[model samples]
Target: MGGPGGWWRRKSTPAKVETYTRWSFHFIALSEPTVIGVTAFGHLEARAALLVMVPVAAHVALAMVTASRALDWTVGRRAQPLRLLWALGAATALVATAAVVLGRHGPGGPGEDTGTVLGSVFGATLCYGVGLTALGLKDRRRVVLLVTGFGAGAGLVARAAGMPALAALGTSAFVTAASGFFAATSAFSIWLLNTVYVLDEARETRARLAVAEERLRFGRDLHDVMGRNLAVIALKSELAVQLARRERPEAVEQMIEVQRIAQESQREVREVVRGYRRADLEAELHGARGVLRAAGIDCEVSGETDGLPAEVQSALGWVVREATTNVLRHGDAKKCTVTVLRPEGRVVLTVRNDGATAPHGSSRTGGTGLAGLRERLSAVGGTLDAGEAGDGEFRLVAEVPLTARPALEVAS
Candidate 1:
């Protein structure tokens, strides 16, 4: 036996709750006419009771179908079969109307002719039809006109049929149509509200997916930045160990280089984690030259690094950094050349290195660093290509529009 708090925590989902509520209304609506028909049964002849009950049962069944179709319409789904059911419901109501009118004048007719029993049956059918029409009709003005016409028409027909003077023709028809109209409107309004709730839930799901994708992109960027830098530091430290075994004084210099790279890596990682880090193209060009030269590779940089937008520079700076790191870690390169050009409203950066040594069982297509760069460049409407060019040379090229857009704005 859970407490009230626990029961609330276990409450049904919106879909299940709505379904239960709709069925509850259906049962309540049908019960009223059903009770009336049963009570009138005891007072009438056996043949009269059979005539009244048959139409009442048919009307109830068709009304349920109509309500179900209305619910479908509110949620943007089609209930094509409902047109037939609507017609059947209306036909059964008319039959019940005829039977009730004839019963009042029969040998076993009730004492008074208040028209209460007939109105209840007729009103239920009208309510079902009105509710279905309100949602199925796309035009609001048309729905209003149709509802008004239905009410007025029902009243006029009742008046012409010669109901009792006290429950005059006008009074009888108005009561029936009005009862149906209000019942239909209330049910349709509830269904509309539930539809809105479903749409809101879908929007929330999309928002959450966007957030998750951004987080994944950020994680990939951080991994790309750190992975290459750490690999370079490991190579330097290993080289220092060998030099130390040979008892060379250059071992101390190698150790110092390792220490410097380690410290730089720490600062870069902090900057990346803070999310405000923007790579400098000039700094990367200079750093690439110095690092390649120290590794005994002749490096030449030819480019104007001035007067570029910050976004373009940052994206290209990453290209240069990753290319330099790849040359050191993966190749036995004797020389490397980097070129930058602004042509046709785009800035292009290319890094070409000789003595390329392809990794064991490595395809030209995949690497975390290049893949991450491609994603980053694409965020600013840029592109990257990295693969074997020809004659023992591997090339990495990146191109970006001069007026690069921010990644956040692009995502939006």
Candidate 2:
């Protein structure tokens, strides 16, 4: 039980939606036997009911199998279940015909009410089978046509079996309405599942694009930093080579100048790398707000980073980043609040979001992101705490001891 629960919780949104949809259709198919069987038993003897349920059981099995395949096709996991659809349609026609024959010619009871019970079963079977067939279809017009065809077939068959014209029309209308409802439901479910998957893919694409964009920016910055120095070094080296070839003492000075420029380039590269690694708290805060708002989440930030130590700001900035990412990736958050407070000798940073039932990566279930954050904060004598705050809220608090900053820096 625990293993299954954990697995479910770990599933991404699209996986969960697909799982739910597949199982829902299976259960719907399963329910047909129970509902139709009970109605059959209520109207006929046990033996007669059993006879009627044999084909229903077969129809249900075919529906379940077809629906499963259809769902796979919907997700591009497999081809359409055309053979199963035809088999199910045939089974549905057989069952309805059996019901009609039993009603018109078989033993009767309760003012000949067997016809009424069987007619209802006919409609239900048509509904379930038609809906299952619709799952494999991608076109709205085709689904409409499928339902209409089944309804018309039901009425025409009834009329040939001696049902009054008006009664046959009524049966047709009933079957159409019932089958249309289930067909529409199946169509909508497929649409929703597809939409969810598309949105999930789009989100992942957006994240990848952001990473690529950042890489380009970093490359551009590095180019700008190194371009001029390298050009000058190349020019000076050529001049040095010419002077050396001419046996001039100026070659030595030119070589030294080239070495100096090379060393300066190395230093600038280190500065660029260091700046890239260090996170600025003020920039992170505004960036988080912009990103969250762009994703349609409301973000409220409260706090000032003025006078905070560089190490403290860097550690807290990382916390904000990880928290924001988790909110976007794991939870369906509508609003988030980030607060920073300085009390006594410690700086406290709190990030809260009303999107999760339980806090993600609480101490009990340490996650990679949170563990990395803890390591970063621990370097600066900080501690991290995360837990649920009730009413579908999760909060993460990080506190860094300001008084220990000097000692930490000295130790580092």
Candidate 3:
């Protein structure tokens, strides 16, 4: 009842179409022997029919095994032994089928007729071809040659055994080989199509992972930029309230400073949110030295951050910034050291601070800043470790490969 365009509209997706095609070939492969058995039923006596069943069943079983091996090979697994076994089985089944089909009509007197013998040959050849093609051999030309040789040899043997039509041997051999060739190539085509589908899905999965990683990076950056500033703003606001209660004139200045920091923090958050926040290694190092010095803590930075990739610098700069923030906000330190070294094919950044703080649980364990830094480092094939060092010292170490994978490239 549907029009011509209706079929087109009702067509399934490419994945569904491929699945249907694969199953269709499987159905053909599984039913080929049955179809051949049914066609030769009327001509075959009861004993002959039973005899043909042996080779037919073996052929079907070998075909299934061959297809399984081909799939294994397609997915990059070992299948050499199975492929060799299938080849031997196919040859045996082909010979058995040909003999059973031709021998049914006695020695002379129109033995099994030419048409029936050729039809049986064609079906057996098709089964062998499909099974061989599923093997996914590298040299297709060799497969073609092998199929042709087998088909021709079968026809020659039939002619030598005095089949009815001797003149049609060449035609039957060519037909048998051609049918086998087409069936094998068709099965290979289905395998290739399914492989392409798998690659496309893998690409899609990588794309999704990229998007998710970018989101995480952005979130981490935002948290790192806002966490310390918000904490400082809260402390200052509290002090300003205390001063205002005491009617101190310094309350106005403190409130103004708090407002300025708040506004700056807001702008910085926007930069991070827009993905335009790139931390400068030199700037972070200089800032850390100055801030620690201002807090009466001796800070030493030993590193040459030049000649580093922008992405690498940005990632390392974030680490320095977060480490500095944690040192200032959490630890009572007398001295802090930041060392950056490029050894072999790696960039190592270590921030060690000697602080006498008891093991009072801090956000470094599950803090957003350190956690985000970890994620950022992971995205660039880097690692981060932050914990208490011996003798009341906390250390944060981040290491990234010098030839780290570019952020734009997705890892396979």
TM of each candidate vs. truth: 0.61, 0.63, 0.52
Supply the global lDDT for candidate 3.
0.68
Q: Which stretches of candidate 2 lie over 4 Å from their true place?
A: 109-113, 239-251, 274-412
Candidate 3 has a TM-score of 0.52
lDDT tens per residue, model 2, 49-94: 7877888888898899899899999999988888988888888888
Clashes per candidate, residues 3 or more apart or on different chains: 1, 0, 0
lDDT, candidate 1, 1-412, per-residue tens: 3686665456546555666656865775577466757655655566655666676677666666665666666555765445754575466447545644553554545344324445445555455545544544555666666566656655555545565554555554564566456546655666555766677788889899989977876777676567656766777788888899999888899888888888887887787777767888999999889888877899999989799987888888888888888888786889999999989789999999986574321345587777768877887899998777788788888999987575643211
Most accurate candidate by TM-score: 2
Task: Indicate the residue-level lDDT of 265 in model 1.
Answer: 79
Q: Give the Å shift of residue 351 in candidate 1.
A: 0.5
Instruction: List runs of model 3 lying over 4 Å from the truth.
Output: 1-183, 285-313, 332-350, 356-368, 371-386, 397-412
Worst 10 residues of 1 by lDDT: 106-115
lDDT of each: 0.69, 0.81, 0.68
Name the weakest run of 10 consecutive residues (lDDT summed) in model 3: 356-365
